[model samples]
Target: MKPFSKLREECGVFGAALRSGEAAGLTYNALLALQHRGQEGAGIAVAREGAVFCRKEVGLVSEVFDGRALESLGRAGLAIGHVRYSTTGQNICENTQPMVIEYLRGRIATAHNGNIVNALELKRKLTEHGCVFVGTGDTEVIATLIAYEALRAAAPSPDPGTAPADPAPSALSAPAAPDSAVEAAVVRAAKQLVGAFSLVVLTPDKVIALRDGTGFRPLCLGRSAEGYAVASESCALDSAGFTFVRDIRPGEMVVITPEGVTSRQVLPAARQGFCVFEYVYFARTDSVLDGQSVYQARYEMGRMLAAEHPANAEVVCGVPDSGLEAAAGYAAESGLPLVSGFVKNRYIGRSFIFPSQAQREAAVRLKLNPLSFNVAGKRVVLVDDSIVRGTTSRKIIASIRAAGAKEVHMRISSPPFRHACHFGTDIDDEKALIANNMTIEEVARHIGADSLGYISPAGLKTACVHGSLPLCMGCFTGEYPLFVGRHTKTQLETR
Candidate 1:
């Protein structure tokens, strides 16, 4: 089988509950709002009285969960949900998220939002200890590790037959001995795990939210009339009618229960390396990440790209959704006409599901049909967020040429991806990256574009003015913030 082309984003996790009742409906709503983050699969898990009920499938949230499944998942005061886009693992039903594990003590259902760099090593060690895995996914590996560590913490007294103290119905009280014990167990487990992760776990007693020490991914807290919610992106909270409270601090764990929300610091705050792509392409335009609006960031990128690479063209067009904002900025700066050259099919859910390569190519055409009238005999400048493998750019150029464009100049908003990213953005294997092997001019000629240019790394830094903290240009510059070995097929498959 051919290696799959990697995209730039990963998954989204949402967990919420109303102290009054299970948040099945609200979680469903939140997942719907976060569906933009992942379209391949979705799942929801609800915990009630030490037992967990879950429903998941390989499809969009609407396709997977209906009235029947929602009712079946039923009401537990605690529920966690996930939408997944496969990064390292195969896209299968078993890999769909919110993995639930039933242990000797209680049940834990977890949904994770980022990739673990040392997942394969951890999996190997766990398997040697007779840990059986049902799914070939990194999220499952995390769930197993957390469970293993929790069990280890509970050892020396195998059967501590004490029930966790129940909180008062109306007042917030100190966490019971069991709650504190489990919290310590999870903290110890998290310390052992490395790489990028923003996780939400539904335990029998509370919902725990945790972010990695470096804050590689974004996670925020929100509040609804029913209760508090935690999600990967703030836009989901907005769509679900929740007020944005604040972002979950890096390395912080906040446990929400009937007694109210309590936070504990598992690790001290450090310089955050949130994925810059979140602002460029991944997040919804309306979403604000790290005190900046995604739309504004892209707009600034476009303006900066225009200043760096001033192109003379009759019309400027972006490659569908992600590129649209930058294209608008380019047109505004270059004094060129901005036209909708391509019309995207909003109904297309997942781009990877097309039956064959030919079908996938055709799907691209069907997904974004070009406006012949807008490009005929005109010089067109195409703007896109980034070029991953050059396949998409080649096909897009073909579309523009087929539409009778005389000249096609390609402009990229972000610098070329020359290194693999271990912090959530799904860039895998430097050998597969076109920029790593070929220069910009070579890639332009290979893709049949007249000219191609990328925004300089300096411009990327200048786009953010308020802070002098350095951004992770690892994918562009091959300088990683964390040490990550070159990823191999063996490692990805086994993990």
Candidate 2:
């Protein structure tokens, strides 16, 4: 059976460069904070004394990294970690990230957090050039490309049978240090990429943070008394006691070394395409993305939603978690009382991960139950981040009605998904998306809601106006930032 229907972001990446203390432990804590971005698998790679040790598995961070696992990683001053929900590969152990590649020059570890549109094309070229691969994930392909570039740069030019006379010492410039070569190699590899990616790399001498040219994914630089850190979101930095340094710009490369931090624009940025859904649903409420507060954005979205779609309801209730803040704004704007209408089972993981139809249905039921006291006998404005397939939303509204609610009105904080997302978001088949085929009124009827309203693209822009750049609404509109070509998750996996 197909998995439960919901939009899923690819993954989250965290990297730390500490002057002292265990970087691996800090990475673990940061990964916990980023767990919401991805929950299928977790991994961490630590560098110590010029050696990189990686521990990864197909499970939650807490499940995969026990006391023994952390100890096995040993003490390290530099580390990078990743939590993954596969968009281009299966949710298996081999695809878990922090891909460590050992080359003639040195070793480097990479943790990536987005999909690569041309990964298969790049993989084919690499294979033709005799690059062997282990995992089917795009991250491995990326790491191998970096290693290939670094090695190719470091390798002595193929035997020119007749050697030219050596130039005078003063006439020739010194060869690049291993660290400099690796940084340049990353820039080269990044320039060849054609999709969303915010990745962190642990080199032999430094930690590198690189974001795609379009800034399709969020990545930031942070600092503390000990050293510097880079994370997919600012909230992860906070978990490790790091204060927010400025966000890494689009196509920028920030290298953290023992000497200090240095930055350069590795690739000239294309159009600013930061994902708008980060505010709508993906990021943690506490995270600040590209100078905008996630919580503030969601609150504003809710306020806009209320203004656009006023529900004649007595009480406002948010779908648990992401929807709560928006619900608060809706309640505040509509002058309706905001109450917790559902009791959530905190221990249950995201319902979308359940594989079987029966299991997914059960997960939804076990995950949240309508609180009869608040929702019963009252008109309810039900606020949620989105409705992907309409199945979960239908189930939720049915549960509320079963609890005796007089009327349930549905409100979404973002525009409907009318197109497929070519970036990291797993909005694969347009045919599978409910909004793609059904009109607003049709969707409302299908989902059993008395009324339904979706925040307009304009309203979403207004709410997220604080962002440093323009938003990517390709999933809402057909216009995308880059040439998506014929890329799909299935093609990425099979190729």
Candidate 3:
């Protein structure tokens, strides 16, 4: 079992098309801003002189792409990068992305965020047609799919020495236009995908960006004097010194080249299923997703949580990182003093893979230590994003009690996590979910909290009302925006 009881999103993706300067360095900075999304692996692929060069490894962004590695990629006008925490494949170097594939047309590098639900089906078909895979992750499947479509579009007719099929004519794909065939291929490949995905494809001449029909993941456009940038969140754009442009609309595909940018409606708009957890936990607080401020959303969640489950405590304290903003809102709404209850060690990464239970329990303190001065002899209301399996919560509440807190009343900012997330957020097993087996009171007792309260689903939705799209509350409500069936990470990675 893992030590930390938290959900994990799959990956963060970034792409840049610059008129001057090396894109690899700018992409590195963007990945750093997005490091919160994933830490298991990092990669960057640069398109240079009709060739693609990529460096990827199973480690954090800074660890994987040191100065030497970044320098080795050389200066390039187009680049795409990824930071990954595996939801579909094992955490190995082979699965680390910005998957660079050499295709019939040329070389293209692709970075992806979000889960592809029908990956297995697609992979089987591709395999039957003699496509061999070197990586187990779905991203390779997606990249190959695009390459296959592009090859199909450019293939000659079956008849004797006939000319190749005309590339489907559209505003973006004018007949006989070789440059736009890749864009058409992207559209065709996107139509076959069944779940959440935001893709950035780096070709020698241009970068292409696409989002799912339902917009289950976030993707946005950015602009600089040099050129355009694409990222999973607006915070990365800010980190890379780019101005936030409008979000790439649901089902929209934007092609960025040195000449400028053009867009095509790759997939028709489905029911807007923007992942609500982006605001609840997955995103950086600084990010703006689909026009909603993640910080403001969390603040409102805190306010709503206080209204719905006001704690009888002398001080309000949030779990470090994600909980701090909500805790501030809780304190403001409840008229309680907001206090720092824990000092987090910034160096420790997620403690989810300790070898033993004893070591796992001990690792909790290595990451966060209670500030005994603030909590001692005070009734403390502890706010957190959510409790996954209750292990970390138990450890945290125990530490607060040991610190001489009079009481530790736990308040959760989001609704209970009950179902498995099949859209990129990692949940080990639905059966392992604490809420699946325990009642609210039982969970509170299990976590050793004096009292516990969870914000209602309605409250969570209201908290994120600034969002332009409808929310996907699948994990909380067990009713996904699209068909998920009984898919699991284990199943996806098994073969």
Candidate 4:
């Protein structure tokens, strides 16, 4: 296996409703709060008196859903939204979600927050059976699978007693009844899926939220005076003025209607394996996942790293964004002066769009400018969340050196990534991972740092304070929690 490299983000899903009025605005607000989870695409799906209307585009939520688009989406009692980061395929306009599928029974709009590992295999099977795909996203594969199962479940049986509820002739073109038949069909379809996923589906009459058995991603439920809401993070719900109800249990499926919410178990309960990286890198500091504060967890990680690898340096600085909290913790623990060594340009979006290596390097300069006063003639301890390809780290280190730092030591908060992640995380092939190609000493030299250290796997687990559950540390240990095929070679060749 090649070394694990930084992968793109999966996506974020948000759904909401107000009992008294339209939910499009609330859903928009929720999407904005969850925007950190993805930046490539955004969309909203609304249902008004059984009619589903949607507006989606390839851009940030603020750019995609303007007044005109919102007006076209119209008012609705229920709405579901999505912010996307491509994991399975290239990011494109057609791949923006929440994907709306109008089936024979009713219209269903779905937004998903994780990758389905077996999606390619399932998509092939479905395609051979005459299923047509509109986009190259895994969410579409899931939607098509559900539609197929629902249609099969709707088939008339030789024994009338076992037949699914037949739609009334007058209601043939309307939404199907939200009865056991439809729920059973959903459960059956869910069973066929493999990998991490937290999904919210909007039907003509109800909203359904489901999490994979292992619960690798976070999904929470909330309530407002209007109705119920489901979001990828509690922060989004809080921003949208909803009270946190609870997290969707692992392997649990929930259906919410005007009457009440119903729960069903599609898989047996097992040990929870929520991703520890959510606290370290993925989730926003203001959010909580699996009952743990993301900010606190990251702070603890920095504290632990300092205890393990205290550096004698004049100033301690962190990489922008993800590493800031950890740097603070390191500074506090090491009693080193915390200084802002680099000023990051808040305007730059994702790094993938920088057309060339020189442009990408220039982007780094534009995104972060070294503060001469902070590092001139001083020994610097640089704290970063992780080092994937070592490209960004190399640039930052060179910049710090150029700013007159006497010596620079790099400290990483997470264990070295040695294997690829098959879950929804964007870790690509292992060959691109610095840890795979170079030892710690080599990596230090490659990045032009005086010294380097990484948090041990044990340290990471300790930081999360998750004792009862096992973590999927595949990226660090090369031991996958589940069966992921031998595609690493193929992935590497393509890369």
**TM-scores, all models, native as reference:** 0.90, 0.93, 0.94, 0.91
User: Which parts of model 1 are misplaced by more than 4 Å?
Assistant: 1-6, 152-177, 351-360, 466-470, 487-492
Evaluate residue 159 in candidate 1 and report its C-alpha lDDT on the 0 to 100 scale.
33
Alpha-carbon shift of residue 372 in model 3 (angstroms): 0.3
**lDDT string, candidate 4, 1-495, tens digits:** 222234445888987755755689888898999888888899999878776778888889999988888888777778899998776655777678888777555677878987787787777877766777767777888876666556545555453223243333333233453434456556666777877889888877677889988888898888877788888999999998989988888889988765567786776547557776787788888887778788877888889999998887888998888888899988999999999989988777654476677875756788889998999999999998998899888989999899999999899989988777777776766666778899999999999999998988888888888423467777888776667785421231121
Number of clashes recorded per candidate? 1, 0, 0, 7
- Tell me the tens digit of each residue's lDDT in model 2 across 350-389: 4357678877565666888999999889999999999999
Residue 35 C-alpha lDDT in model 3: 95
Residue 221 displacement in candidate 4 (angstroms): 1.1
- Badly placed stretches (over 4 Å) of model 3 are 1-4, 155-177, 349-356
- On TM-score, the leading prediction is 3
Report the backbone clash tally of model 1.
1
Please give the distance, in angstroms, between residue 257's alpha carbon in candidate 1 and its true position after superposition. 2.4
What are the per-residue Cα lDDT tens digits for candidate 3 across 349-429?
A: 644577897886777788889999999999999999999989889999998899999999999998998887888888758
Locate the minimum summed-lDDT window of 10 residues in model 1. 167-176
Number of the predicted model whose lDDT against the real structure is largest: 3
Clashing pairs in 4: 2-430, 2-431, 3-430, 3-431, 4-430, 7-426, 19-226
Candidates sorted on TM-score, descending:
3, 2, 4, 1
